[model samples]
Target: MIQVLRPARFTELTGEDEDIPRPPLSQTRTAQQSRRRKQKKQLERRWRHSAVVAALTPAQAAAVATTHADATSALDLLTFLSRERSHEYSPDTFATLALRLVEARRCPADVGRARVHMIRACRTPLEMTRAMDDLDTLARRGPRMDLMAYGALLVQLNTLGMIDVTRARQLRQASTVHPPILVFLATGLVGSQVRWGSGAPLPQGIDLFFLSHPILSTLASSDRLLPRSPAHARHLFDGMPRRKKRQSAPPVSIADRIGTLPDSLLHHVLSFLPVQAVVRTCVLARRWRHLWRSTTSLRIVGLDDNYYVDVEELRKFVDHFLILRERTDLDLVEIKFNEFCEEDQPYVKTWVRFALMCKVRRLTFHVRGSQYLYLDPHLVSRHLRTLDLDGVGLPETFLDFGSCPVLEDLKISHCIINACRILSHSLKHLSIYCCHNEFNCRIHVSTPCLVSLKLDHFIGRTPLLENMALLESADVYLSDYCKDVCLNYDSGVLCGSNNNACQNCVPIEDDCSRECVLLGGISNAKYLKLLPGSKTFVFTRDLKHCPTFIKLKTLLLNEYWCEAPDLDPLACILKNSPVLEKLTLQLFSEGPNHKVEIKGRYSSMERPSAISEHLNIVEVKCSVVDERILKVLKFLSALNICFIF
Candidate 1:
């Protein structure tokens, strides 16, 4: 029901006088005023939260934000939060909240509000059909959210001048009694005339708001006789740019309620789906045919999150996605393989490169099967800030971190690092869990800006760390798989016997050197936990030259620190830490059969200043009550400070 492009008198259309002046430009707060108010509100927010923030240490603050951002009250974080203390949540509000949310962006619920307004403005089916077409034309410009702010179009700010003149005429006619772009231009939106010009959808992200001010409405066409787009640019004005007229939009079904949604919103909804499913949407309607190609977020999984991905289909999709799609910024990209053969590693690597090439800010790569996706030197992205890798392999070259300059947090689990050195200048936090190496090389890490480090249950040689001046908290665990076994061959040779001495049967830290590597690097941490494996002696070896932990306030050690022979390691650390206040020991002691006593051993170990002066609390957890357990109780009794079991 495309309305004929003809002159329709406003007076005749709605039985009213045609002398009505163009509605005064809709007024709103200015950007500068809005900014000032926004700043003022921000200051107020800071003031309100300042006390709680001041009470938190940096580590606690980071933890709280990480753990609380997804709490129930954070639901409003996805959209503009209600500023009013007594805001009403009407029944209709629930409809908008029903939209699926991708982590980075949300499918706006208000997308159809303006369309509904247009429908309401229409007096008949003819007008309704014409209005729908006008919406198509309005969308020819990208589905820019600024235009769709709060579900309303910002017509006054349109530089393309491609208004729905047809709808404008209807609104003008309706306004005679009540109210209402293509000849129905979006005049009512910004209170400015939509100049007749090119149709190629407006470019995405166009908001030279200053240049497209409502004051530029003086350039509107004189009457309702719908004008075709201009031939070419003569002299350019603020109202019109030199864009060629876009072809008339594909016909939209007059009955389409959901199709009328802005593409930006639709794409957001589609982002929650894997690309395989996004491709299926093209068959739904003509408008959706090319929509999949423009989506900014990508999830390269099987058809769904519970993926049933086929290799050949994924291959075809990968090629189609990269080749057919227009270049755009990726907010978040994830590639998770539930199950795939080892041969697909190359394809997975290629997919990772594609995500990186799009400048993704957040990426998650998981190869969930027995296979691991080997990271390459080309894993670069200036925009990459957070990366989560599971079941992946890191090559020696990949550890340099020259690729991702802005990478801040990296969490790797169930992975293998075949690297000797791990260095990153921009990384703030690094966590590696259940990861191991192929050989006996001790990984060396030099991250001067690191704030938090966690190496839990990692295997292979104990890592040698340095240059961690900014470290605040560390949790290092030496699992049974760790190559730090010490079999005392003979006391005379320290860790060896005669020529055949192999007392140091495993990968123990070199005690021959005075430069403390592992313990010294993390000495600045305020909170430290060192959990050693049942027989691993890496902590003991490092204890020989452990650096003074000047900032330590809390420490947690394991049973090995007080093994029957000596409590020297515990004494050494306690002596080094001046401000230490709390100590916790978790023991899995053997029963009474093991000869354990502090009577002789405690006297041999010199008392650390922290124990006599600063130490306030001690906690001990035991596997069983035995002679060894009694010895630990004896030691706690001597501390005088209260002890918790």
Candidate 2:
């Protein structure tokens, strides 16, 4: 049912063809010559990349020229150069170029017809095969592709989904000894799920765990990588050097490969993993199985005891773990047990002795139990620099640390202090929290090198200090128990560790005050933070009896329950600290039970007589500014001090 219509003659048709004259040959030849000249000029201009070539050294330049002739991609150019020019170009330069190519999708830097030809000819598999054949033909005329060249080719083919088992295996063989190259191939094969156990067997001497992601993840998760934006592969590549080629020697055995690493290096590598993860490396080979024994840093902490059906098995693991370690010096040994019976004490103490014999530098012990476990003071290492203990009992000779000669930091929390005197010449930092003193045991510090001290919720007679001239900072916090004791004025007097306070202590304002003992010890502190349990206990007539703070520069009264009776004590400290530079007053908040608003202004006031010439900053932290706060601000402003609320 189709119909066609044709015109009888061209002259008769509505649109007729008329003869048009052709241009002269002379003019056409001139136009063709002009176009040819422009094309030749552009081609000549692109024959050299001055800027890119200027930055390359002789070896790198040679590698660049080789890759330029072998491949048609900016990505492939850098990939081959990274391997061939590794000795000339730093790993960072290779990493940077590789990262740049990947990020920019490998668009060529060449500005000519060849850049467009490369883009069209190498993006697909069929076209790339022809290009590779051309490269192979050229390679045969010159030098064979190196291992790095093979790795680059494999990476490109695998990324384009054109790689097969046989080809990949062949490529892996060329780069078998180079772990960095192997890792690169492995990452490319990740999405493809290629396995060497299947079709084509991996070449001999290759690691059986070539496909594993653990080492890859470890290298990738380092601080120099991922969180820093995932392009910093230089650090990961820095550790990988070119493998030695020994064609005549026997095949590399497991013992000859991983065993060749230095003991220090193996130990350092193992330190990044926990004991359990470290133990798993033993299964890799016989040589690696025992390498965990040389690891100097050990951290044994977890709830495995509670999770396991048999706790004895966990204990056996811990014991075996300690027994297998070498007796070399240790950098750190931290053991925390959630709960242990009394029977486990001897076993634990034996392990402690083992660690001490190894000269542990940092030791942390945490044991949770009902009965207070006593730690033998003699087991402490003489080289111990830092010690932390929780939920334990200190022996009578705990402070007599003749063994720990270099101990610099000590932290004791929720423990019983049986020692009355803490004497050490090397101790610099001390912290005690929620500790109770035994009867007849009043804590005393005799460390001349102590620089920082923090005492929180300590129940004992005020601590005594001697030769603390170097103390730079001190923070003291009294517990709620002190508040209860102060409120119970009818109790007569505060009892000391010796029940003999009847003669040694004096009664002040219906309660016994040991403010002198506490204040007298920290007179040399440049920065002091004090949190009294109750206002009446410290804000007494004895406040004026304390010595002058010639070294005090900054004073912080935290959680101060400001009241009408607190001004005298505040003035007392200000009067004593003549050179105080900064004062911070943080008001206390009371819950529903003690909701007494501090709003009333003092009827009469007497400011500190000391000249606060150096007191330039006064900061008041509170929710609401009451009349009492305004009065204090007015008094401080009279001395030209800056107020910050």
Candidate 3:
């Protein structure tokens, strides 16, 4: 009786039985659970409904509906839909979807597919009618519609090859939407039979208008809307009546018509010609006499053996050019001379002075002289934002860019700067290439704003680059003869067992140790050039204490050796670079045989075991096909490489 008093019946279970009453359902919890279940059911229902609706499409509609929303999927779908009949879908839906697809970019495949679909989707007469309506809507909006977008649509329509005359006429008229429209139209017109006759041709001034418009000029030659026949097109252009001449025109002879062109247009045309041609054209007429002086940029490039020109003539030409530009601020001036004589020094100095006076924005001087020439420090350090000097000698007096203030870039190659303390507070870029001399040159750059520094062929035992807080990227190439080393010899800790100069010297205060990169051993040869040759070489290794470049992303190692000393240094670099993405190695050899030897060494070094762990992408280009090339391929393959040959 104690255990089996039957669980109380409903009548006996009233109110409170001995057993704890089941807890009353909490209203809040019950309501929340109900809501969640309801929401889930609604989602499932909606998804099912969408699937059913998609399955009801015609053959074309089915293809489009099944088209992957992504680029690849869209492309595949479009290709399939192109061959299908247009009667399979509602024209309105097709046009709407096509427009939407075209507007998206992530789905390039999809856009391409939609384009093909739109082209083939218009096979039906009804579809074509709908497309024309769509075009009309687009046209009515005028400038609201992007000219490029509209033109692209029209091009797609034309490419379908099924457009009727009326549609073609609409397409042709669309060209007037913008100047770029003309290019697409012109492209379509080529090998095309569409005609909008009896209508007056576009105004003759259109060509002149396009000449001044960057976008229009870019598309003028390939205008598909323009007539294809060059002669007919010329006639059409010429047929348009010219503006009436003023009765009171400036007093000018008919012989001067050649020079009567507007200075701006003349300059534009001349800009496309070679510098030599530009000089020759200056002799055309009085109006053209000062034309070359008006050039904003000048580049003097030497040809093969003809690169050598008479120094006197070159100096005279520069002198004349500078005098003519006395009043105007030259934007860019470049001078390349194969050789400079003592007599030419005065003229070169004058040119530099004038450039500084005019506040030249960009200046480049490449002069090859036997003896070092002293360049005025003041002229060398001017308002120049960009300066590139190659093979020019620097004065003994260290160049002090007393706050080049605005100098952003400085590049010097094959130049001798004897113990210069370069001080440019605003210098953002510094590149120096020293070849064939360990001139004991010490560069002390105190540029807090420097962002990039590149040093090549440095032979100094101690190269100092201090206090560049903003430095971000650096490219350094050391020579083999000069061990890559850094020293605090001021405190005196002589490094390298090979150097017995200070064997038992007391440690100096700033006794910084020199880090050397040795590349003489055969094991280190793998890291050396893939090709070998008796090419001119420079050896120096004084660049070791340069600041870390945290923002460096692309690194190009022109000629690198993988010696034991270089391993730890390179590892340190890789450890510091957290965002490096691309690495390119360029190798060159003096001769074919030398290239083979270098390539063989490169092959051995490029083995899978030799690749750095941090490398994500590697590109190796070897001029000669040898074992080195094969090794690189294998190395890259082990990493599942994306290689280009």
Candidate 4:
């Protein structure tokens, strides 16, 4: 409550006393009215103080301290409480108010008024010392002075230096608290100590000490007793820029820090590190020993030292890790094992089943061995989105991913395709690389949603394709070895003398049937990259039954062998693809003697009358284009197509 000050008692309001002379009778009436007004205002302030004290709960005060834009008001409230209701505020309460006030700029009057409250908040010496220490630490870390103040200090130093017209002008500037000036002073002191020593003569009745030492001394004095050192001079060097090295922070265990975080957050952090590193965290402290069981993502890569060194140990660890996972849902489960023992097969199957049981979304396996690893069909999960299998063959029935509904991307590399059919409804991307077709393997696929398909170094009878209406792009490369059977065929003069042997010769119907099925499936592809590995068989094998690529826009022919007959397949593809826009010929030949001759645009058959309006760009990637290649270029130029070689 605000105490009304009497005329003679100044301390009642302002905390001071002053005597006032009494007014005459004429002024007495006005003085009486003024005293009554003061009393009424004091009474109103007392009631308001009571109401404010009742409303200002601890939570409300903290809220105001955090959200209030006017910090001066908060400081004033605390100051008023300190004066009227001093017992209500604790050390923590005042400390919080003081911090808020320090964080924002307050008026000089408000700061002075709050100073008393801040003092009262820390009633004990220890509390005040702790508060001061915290403030000092904050000040050391925060900016010593703002840019504006720094600029003003520089200006002051410049003005002071102008008074001295000697080299000592810099020394005069160094006496200021400017950081650069202080650095210069410290450097000068070091140099002085290195150059001068005790051999130097000493002056009478004068004392000196090293600037680095916290010692006080006088330059010279002849007073009755001993001379006193100047306080200002002693403090002048206190602003040296050399910061005292801070003590190293105390050692903190990883488990202690991790234990402080929520279990979910700790699991997420562990997920990014390798499984080995995650397991190693158990040694940090007792709290982290069981934390690995909470991780949701598991990536077991066998190529690393932590994985395949001991297959048995790795198997046991994985089994334990999976069994301990309390959560039912997992984000990713990846297992990449280059090689493992036959005896470890059961453990691998168990690991996969466990992952399926947990409803893992993405699964990958790279386990390789002599025989194909048979996976249980019942272990499939519908939540799977991506399934990548490398160096691991699949069973004939496992190719169809009906059990995995949401599977969108599939990859098979260096594996045997014993399956007769590969079908999926939700698949968008499919890649098969270096895959061998088993004996009697009749590969087929009917993925209507497939958008991108890549086939490289594929060996086998062509897979039957159906319902691939949405197929947009395809990269097909038949291996050179696959065409060895077709190359051995004797077409013109086939051993007429040995008529009986001629009957046993290879039949073309089987090869043509495979080509027909494969080409029919990818007929709607918009972009096709056909890398032919054989010079003659590729054209003779498939060109007869090649389907129309009405939507074909881009065609790439990677010709590694520049044989004269290699152009036949490319010519067939170009003639059939009417809408093809960009033609790229990737040529790689070692011999300069090799040359290609294109007598005409294509075979002697009459050229199609329909001019390809979209066929505008022709690109040839080869170092040397001989006369034969020039003839082909000239023919393309006649059609007004641009050539970029």
Each model's lDDT comes to 0.57, 0.57, 0.48, 0.56
Model 2 lDDT tens row, 285-374? 667977786688876655352432222434667765764454558988877665667777776776677678678899888766566778
- In the range 1-645, model 3's lDDT, one tens digit per residue, is 111222222112111233423233455656745653564344334434453323323543334443434333223222333333223444454445555555542223333334334434565555665666664443332222244444445454445543344543543344324433445445344323323242434333332333433334444444443565545454545665889877874865567665778877776676554356677876776788878756656555443324655456566555444433314455666666666677777767766766665678898887665555557755454567998888766664535666466888889888767644667777888887773333543345566677777766655533455655565566555543332332322211224323543432222324223422211111111122211111211112222432343455555543332222323333444444445555555534333234332211112235453334445656554467655456444544554355544
**Cα lDDT of model 4 by residue, 394-470, tens digit:** 77778878888998999988887777778788999999998888855347777999998997887765555675789
Lowest summed lDDT across 10 adjacent residues in model 1 is found at 174-183
Task: Output the lDDT of residue 623, model 1.
Answer: 56
List the RMSD of every prediction in angstroms: 22.1, 24.2, 28.9, 25.6
- Estimate TM-scores for all models: 0.53, 0.52, 0.42, 0.52
Tens digits of per-residue lDDT for model 1 on 203-285?
33222321232222223333333222332121223355669998997885587777889988998899899887888899988
lDDT of 4: 0.56
Q: List the residue pairs that clash in candidate 2.
A: 282-289
Best by TM-score: 1
**Cα misplacement distance, residue 426 of candidate 2 (Å):** 0.8
When sorted by TM-score, best at the front, the candidate numbers are 1, 4, 2, 3
Error of 4 at 134 (Å): 55
Candidate 4 Cα deviation (angstroms), residue 409 = 1.0
